[model samples]
Target chain A: MSDIVFTNVARNFRRDGKEFPALRDINLSVRDKEFLAIVGPSGCGKTTCLRMAAGLEFPTSGTVAVGGVRVTRPGPDRAVVFQQFALFPWKTVAENIGFGLVANGVAAAERARRVADVLKLMNLAGYESAFPHQLSGGMQQRVAIARAYVLDPQVLLMDEPFGALDAQTRVVMQEELVRLARVNPRTVLFITHAVEEAVYLADRVVVMSRRPGTIREIIDVASVRAADSWDRFEKIEDVMDQASFVHLRTHIWRLLREQQAPDDH
Target chain B: MSRRTVVGIATLLAVAGLWYLLTAATGWVGSARFPNPAEFGTAVKQIVTGGYAGARIHEHVLQSCKLVAMGFLVAVSVGLPLGLLMGWNRRAEALINPVFLIIRPIPPLAWIPLAIVWLGLGDGAKIMVIFFAAFVPSVINTHAGIRNIEPFLIEAARMLGVRGPRFVFGVLLPAAAPLIFTGLRLSLQASWTTLVAAELVGALLGLGYVLNAAAQDIFPAMILTGMVFVALSGAASTWLLGRLEQRVTRWRTA
Candidate 1:
């Protein structure tokens, strides 16, 4: 069964007496355990797409479904890792991770056990008692990831989850996410503006056109994973040379540049 | 000693020295009005020994503390929930804000006459006056604290399956706690100040009553002692509130 499905989804936002369309005709589906990255320029509705999937926002038209069920509101079955590392500032690392479980009426002992496991998985074992403000930005994001993961959601919606970190930290977080995806096999709909991030983490990278965003192309990265002993950085040229990757990147870049151009109208 | 402790002691000594200097410098001009430090100390001793107007200073201090405590409790109990509702619901804010706006500008002292008329110049009137003094800032600060919380935090909580009253208690309250405590502390100070003011009219046993009686008797030393007791109580209340704030916010610092 498809883990997530978006059928002709549209999102329109109203501001200052103007109706701005954020997403238009978004039609996509992800199979079970698929790692799909949605890539687009800023304001290209990538985050809005993830928010819609996570049920934080409603589509102006059509439906967003997960595991064959339509989404109307946020639930514990689908967890979200926000871009801003939205860890509760007043809560300890452990408390933040356990929040979802607590909200769902899990026993204290069970909640603590799950929190402890994620803390170890995220390499944050000794810092469980530390407040979010006390942690570094990278560490805070780790807490956010752990919080989402501890809920054992059927699908994970990550909205540029590593965008706030330093470049080195971002790479490390990306690699960590890749490792996490490998172990858990959760259907993850990741969103990012960075082409490299989308290419590195996704099983298939879905490139999006600039605002009033529509899917430009979907490039399967399965071949890159199939290659043995390949260095991601070293094989960048080879990866880009793939007909699908080339076509998708070119189409997306052209769309973005056209949107940025100065127009008299 | 810590720098804060040293500075605090130095300030106290300087203030005491100034009081002594002022009384001594002004003695010839109004000996009945201003008392030197030694005379004030003598009056304190007399009060302790039941030699000053046959009323013990301890009774006045106790009465003032009781009134302040009762008024502070009443203010916090009413203000916090009102503030939280106003902050959490836009409709509640719209409905209640006008009332608070009209009432807030009038000083608590202005409520004294009404309180006395309603409650008959008793403990009820005194407590009501103090409550009126403290309630506005407490409610205003609590509302500000809740309103100032980042909207992203609320969205994050909601997305985590925390909604309704559970969300308010589990997420919103903790997030707004520090600022709410600040409001509570300010209200406590207000209550302490208003307690003395309330006692000024027809109160039989408070510090203010004793001070007024001392002034009428031209007993400058007794007046100074009464003023010192009032200052001490205010300082003590402030110190207690600081400790409470530290305890409440310790988790955020962890």
Candidate 2:
């Protein structure tokens, strides 16, 4: 079971010789093939939580296990898609996607085949040789997502991957994401501040509290999808319009809003 | 040609015409102070055929270019890797930075006396001075380039399981390359200028040596000829470097 288990996780950041907690007691068990979106207000340490799963970070005091193995450093088992669409600027679209395969010592012919297949899967067939700067924000993020997915990792950690795109592009990406997840499911920890996004795509939504973040609420969004999956609504707009979607989105929004610091209000 | 190139060419032609009117055509500036194109042409022919000091004009140009190439290549070989080490490892930076801080403030010309004392008045001393000139920028800019990179890119690579030497070679080197090239360009300019100044006091051959001899002899035409060759050679090296930089970083939008 390619599950991610975060046991009593806490993390602190030091700035100017001052120590401040960023997350505390983040106990999340993201099940295999589950789409778990962690939603909260900005500075809620949602991204930090995702980074720990990617093995790019460590908790000050807890065990983060991927497929039952304790994460110490980044390994081939997990892939991350960052909010900045951090594609290697020197590498082409195809090169970026195949970077993991290369790192794994996958031979050239096989690497090309898998990269080409994933390119088609992501609807990025014709833009292989193009650079990241040449592509629009949506297309660049698609490449980033494609890069992570091509790894065939046990877990995919995304830190607000769609947060940089325009509203229209973000919705379209969400739709594409839903379609892809249905076909090739993997345990995914997606972090976002968008309530509709957290509600529209996740099987379960974990709402986080303000800094020194904690799991304020764990929401089951898939109940409304008794027989039909969220992918049933071909368009993100259609999913956003569902009565159940609106209720869940509003509930998560209210939960997140309450967690915002009082001083800010 | 594009509008920009065409406009640039026209501006150069306009300046040349103004120079011609001032010295060659009107004789208003006086040829003694500023040689006419014809007088400059005569000087160029004399240097080309008769030779200057101990060598021909082309030989002097070749010598200067060789000195620059030697100094620049050595600096790049040593400085590039040193910069990478410092940029990649904090411990390396801590170890190297103090010495680098002490060495960095001294001008390349300041080393002339020491270079002569250590290596003597020859190609070796001149090369040493030029090496110091090129070395500083190569290190500083390379370090800056690596530090300036977005930290997220490193996270992305690490997540993809790229670390250790692979991370340094595959990720850091390429990411910092454009800025490294920027440093190389500065180093190139430094090498040229430093070589000239060093050669002025110590060299038997080179453009600077030619210029020094010309000034002493009060041969305005030869001085003009020497200055033109120096400018021409500097432009040539910079142009070649620009092409290489473009090819390496072609992924960037112009």
Candidate 3:
């Protein structure tokens, strides 16, 4: 079953009392356990698509459903990791990660156990007591991802999760995400402006046109992932040097760059 | 001790030495303008032993402190929740802000006449005055604190299945805690100032009454001692509040 499905989805934003079309009749489905990334230039409403699935925003026209049911509001079945690492600053890392469990009425012992497990899974075992400000950007994002993962959500919506990190840290985080995916697979709808990140991480990369964002093309880049390629590659940056990776990245970049050009009459 | 603490203490001492040099040793700046160090010490001992305006130093200090506490507590109890509710709900803000804005700018001491008529010349009147002083900052800061939070933090909390009153208390309250503490700190300061002002007008026994009595007698040293006690009490409470703020917002990076 496809965990997330956006069928004929359209979103219009009201700005200064005028209705501006953001996403135009988008049709996409993030298959169960599949990692689907949407890449586009800024203002393309790629995030709007993710927000629809996460139930943060409802489509103006069409239905965005999960597990065959309409997603009317945010639920425990779907978890979102924001670009800003939107952690509760007053909470310790463990408490921040365990917030969802607490909200769901998990017992204290069970919440603690799950938090500790996720902390270890995220390679943040030693930093349980550390606050969000105390950690590096990469570590904070790790906690954010772990926070989402601990809920065991069927669908994980990541909106430019590595966008705030330094270039080196971003590369490292991408690999870490891939590592987590291998160990525990979940349906992930990733949104980003980076074409290369979309190619390296997503099973299928959805290339979107500029606002009134339409799906220009959906490229299948999963074939590029050799069975042992993730394990063999020391860094996600190493995958960028390969010919197949280069070609796919360039093709998506061209589609995005072409959208920036003046339209025909 | 940390260099910062050492430097702060040294600065205070240097200012004290300057005061002593100018007033007592050099005889520059008349004693009438400011009391000498010896006269200030004698005033302190006199208040401690002989009493000031019929009450001992500790009695005056305790009375002032009690009034401040009552006023501050009442202000916080009313202001903080109102501010948080105003911040969280648009309808609440619309309903309450108009009335709050009308009351906000009026000086707390301006209520003394109304307070006297309403509650009489007891602790109630003094507390009412202090309450107004502390109330404004508590509301303004608490509202601003909730409003100024990163929108994504709210979004993130909702996305994690936190909603309704659970979201407000669990997420919004603690999320805005840094600024709420800032509000509380300002409220504490306002309470002390207004408490003194309230006591000055009519009280029989407070540090402010001591200041009024000293001024009546033209005793600069006694006035200085009263002023010093007010400062001491205000500073002590503020320091304690700051420590609580530090513990609550320990996640904040220095």
DockQ of each: 0.70, 0.74, 0.64
- Compare the candidates by DockQ and give the number of the best one: 2
Candidate 3 lDDT, B48-91, residue by residue in tens: 99998998999999999999999999999999999999998899
State the lDDT of candidate 1 residue by residue for A1-265, as single tens digits: 5399999999999999999998999999987899999887677898888888888899999999999999999887888888888888878888899888888899999888888899999999999889999889999999999999999988988988888899888877877887777677799999887776777678888878777898987887766556632335443456556665666566656655665525512
TM-score for each model: 0.91, 0.97, 0.94
Which stretches in model 3 have alpha-carbon errors above 4 Å? A224-238, A261-265, B1-10, B26-33, B164-166
For DockQ, candidate 1 versus 2, the one ahead is: 2
Top TM-score prediction, candidate number:
2
TM-score on B-chain, cand. 3: 0.95
Q: After superposition, how far is residue B230 of candidate 1 from its true place, in Å?
A: 1.5
Q: How well is candidate 1 docked (DockQ)?
A: 0.70
Cα deviation at A253, candidate 1, in Å, is: 4.4
| Cand. 1 TM to true fold | 0.91
Tens digits of per-residue lDDT for model 2, B59-83:
9999999999999999999999999
Per-residue lDDT tens digits of candidate 2, residues A1-265? 9999999999999999999999999888999999999988789889888888888789999999999999989876888888999999889999999988888888999999999999999999999999998899999999999999888999988889999999999988998898898899899999998888888889999999999789999999888754445557678888778777888888888897789788878
Query: Per-residue lDDT of B21-119 in model 1, one digit per residue for the tens?
Result: 677755653556677777877889988787454468788888899999999989989999999999989999999999999999999999999998999
Per-model chain A TM:
0.88, 0.96, 0.95
Q: Across residues A1-265, which tens digit of lDDT does each residue of candidate 3 receive?
A: 6488989999999999999998997988889999999998788899989888888889999999998999999877889999999998888899899989988899999999999889998999999998888889999999999999999998899999999999999988988888898899889999998888888888999999988999999998886676436457777767888878888888987888888836531
List candidate 2 stretches off by more than 4 Å: A227-231
In the predicted model 2, the residue pairs found to clash are none
Candidate 1, CAPRI quality class derived from DockQ: medium
